[model samples]
Target: MKLKLIRQTGIHVILAAGGALMLLPVIWMIATSFKEPESIYAFPPEWLPHPFTWSNYVETLTRPGMAFLDFFRNSMTVTVLAMIGNIASSTVVAFAFARLRWRGRDALFVVLLTTMMLPQHVTMIPVFVLFKYLGWIDTYKPLVVPAFFGAPLYIFILRQFMLTLPRSLDEAARLDGAGNFTLLTRIMLPLSKPALATVAVFAFRAHWNDFMGPLIYLNSSEKFTLAIGLHMFHGQYGTEWGPMMAAATLTVLPMVILFLIAQRYFIQGMAMSGLKE
Candidate 1:
């Protein structure tokens, strides 16, 4: 009993230490955001600001040519469009893979999985060229349009989740005179809320934080998303640490709120999706 108690205590201590390590950066960022510029880099590295200031947030939000509200609106538009496209496309593709049987289905699945192994950089140039030819550059089309085709990872995840669902459900729908479209819409989609939420959350976050895509495709400053706006805050000679931290905090708020809202569904879908056939 004593030995077991000692081992448990040791495990708790290790876990606490690991938790602190993970939280340290977040703590530092918050601390720095509130500190005055003079005290930001003070010796001994203060964990809490001596005299906290809210000016950073105000300045960050009100900065010239950075229009926080506009950037936020752009981010939200892109995120919402991407989420809709991903959900619609992933659902149909995953349903096909999970419920429909055809020649070369397994081979096609293997090919889909193989694409995941290829680095995004390899295909980025070709994608850029295609978008350029279509006159999609300098517009949101490059970011929003591709999502309608479904992402390979999201399709795979939803397919895995769908596979775990009982075939009896599909049979019942079929007996009710439901065709493929009816079954997919009336049955599969309703039952796959958790998986769909997971896909939506992921796609929203991806497009929300995407800097490179927006930078390459959107030349107009007014159309820039939050990620691009953040990058522009850093000048060539010096960086505005306070405003930068404030903007970083603001940028993360939406993701945090979203995760808090959909975290349960996300975890549940991931857990159930791994069930073996």
Candidate 2:
């Protein structure tokens, strides 16, 4: 029993050390954000600033051409809309894939899975050209309209979760005059809190941190999202390391808060869904 206790203690120590190592960069980012620009590169790399300051946060928001508030609003709009589309569309498609049996359903699902394996770079140009032809080049439509079509990963996650549910519930609902839409709304959605929460968390994070899509589609400064707006911290001469870090911290705060609130559902959904398939 003593030997087993020693092993567990050693494992915990190793895990704690690994976790600290992983957090070092984040710790550094926060420290840098609080440090004076001159103190940032000080020798021995202090963990805590001698005189901490909120100037970085101030400058980050008030920087010329920053428009940080507008960026926040735009990001919120895009992220919320995308999350709604992702959950709603993914749920519908996943229901069809998981519950309903059709002639070519399984084969179509295999094909859908194959599409996920196709690198985004391969389709990037073609999709861009299609959107360009649609005259959506400089619009939010290019970033958002795609969400309503459904996400492959989201669909896969939801379908996996739905499959874990007993078919008896579906059958019972059907007997009670529940059609496909009714079954989904009345029974499936009510019971899919965890999986749906997972989907929302993921969708929120994707749009929140997305840079490439916004860069590619948005041409106007007024239309820039937070990800692209952060780039403004860099000038032709040098990057504003302190204010940029402060901006990054603010940008990451919402995602952290959101994940903390939804983490229980996220973990439970993933574990339960993975157990069956």
Candidate 3:
């Protein structure tokens, strides 16, 4: 018993240390946001700001050409729309893959899975050309539309979770005159909350933090998302560390809140969807 406890304690200490190491940069960013610009690069680094100030945040928001609020709104628009599409499409496709037996279902699913192995870089140029030809350049459509087609990884996660559920529920529902759509809406969806929440969190984070997509698709400053807008902190002369950190802190806050709210479901989904072929 003592040995087991010791092993567990050691493991926990290691994990905690690793976690702290990972969080150091984030903690420093927050600290820097609070610090005055002059004190930022002080030798013998200050872990805590000597004198805290909201100036950085104020400057971040009020800075000319920054349009931080507009950038924020744009990011929220893309992230929320993309997240909704991903959840809806992924869940429906996953349900079909999990429950329905079609002639080529398994083979098609295999092909879908294979697509996951294809590097995004390989398709990026072709996708860009298609979007450009469609006159979607400088629009949010390129960033948000692909999500509605369902991401393979999200589909896989939801499908695996759905498969873990018993088919008896479907039979019982059908006996009560529940059709396919009815089964999905009433039974499968409710039971698959954990997996859905997992997908929601993933989708939100991906679209929220996506820099490359917005950079490639959006040409106008007014259409810039938070990720791309962050580059404004870098000027030809020097970097605005204080305001930049403040913006970054604000940028990260939503994802933090989201994860905190959905952590239970996220953890449950990950735990239950283990290694099922």
Candidate 4:
């Protein structure tokens, strides 16, 4: 018992150390955001600010050429629309893959899963060419429209979770005159909240922090996302470390709060998703 206790204590200590190491960069970013610009590159870096200032945040938000508010609005618009599209499309496709029977369904699912193995870079240029031909270049359509088709990984997650549910629920609901749509809306949806929340958090984070997509497609300054706005801090001559960190902190804070709020559901969904076939 004493040896077991020692082993568990050692494991906890190792994990705590690792977690602190991982958090060091984030901690430094937050600390730097509060420091005055001149003191940012001090010989001995200050772990805590001598005089904490909100000016960095102010500058970031009100920077004349940045149009930070417009960037924020564009990000929110794209993220929310894409997230909704991902959830709606993924749920329907997942339901079909999970509950509904059809010829070649299992084979098609296997093919879909294999696509997950294909790296995004392989198809990036082709997808870009297609969107360009469709005149979607320099538009949010490149970022938002693809989401409406349903992502394979999200579909897999939802389908796996749904597969864990007993089919008896479907039969019982059908007996009560529930059709496929009714089964999904009334019976499956309520029970699958955890999985849905998991997908939502995933989708939100993906679109919110999506840099490459916006950088590729959005040509106008006003159409930039927070991720792109943060990048604008780097000029040809210098980098604005203070305001950049501030913007980064603000950008990351929402995702942190979101994950904290939905962490319970996220964990539960992940745990349950692969519990069955």
Number of backbone-clashing residue pairs for each candidate, in the order shown: 0, 0, 0, 0
lDDT of each: 0.84, 0.85, 0.88, 0.87
How much is the lDDT of residue 64 in candidate 4? 81
What TM-score does candidate 3 get on C-alpha atoms? 0.92
lDDT of 4 by residue, 44-109 (tens): 777887788989889888878787778878889999999999999999999999999999999999
Off by over 4 Å in 1: 265-277
Per-residue CA lDDT of model 3 for 65-122, tens digit only, reads: 8888999999999999999999999999999999988899999999998887788898
List the pairs of residues colliding in candidate 2: none
Q: Give the alpha carbon lDDT tens digit for every residue of 25-136 in model 2.
A: 8888888889997788778778887689999889888877788888888889888888888889999999999999989999999988878778889889999999999999
Candidate 4 stretches greater than 4 Å from native:
1-9, 268-277
Best by lDDT: 3
Worst 10 residues of 1 by lDDT: 268-277
2 or 3, which is superior by TM-score?
2
Residue 253, candidate 4: alpha-carbon lDDT: 86
TM-score for all models, in order of appearance? 0.92, 0.93, 0.92, 0.92
Candidate 1, 64-135: lDDT as tens digits: 887877888999999899889988998999899999999989999998888867789988999999999999
**lDDT minimum window of 10 residues, candidate 3:** 231-240
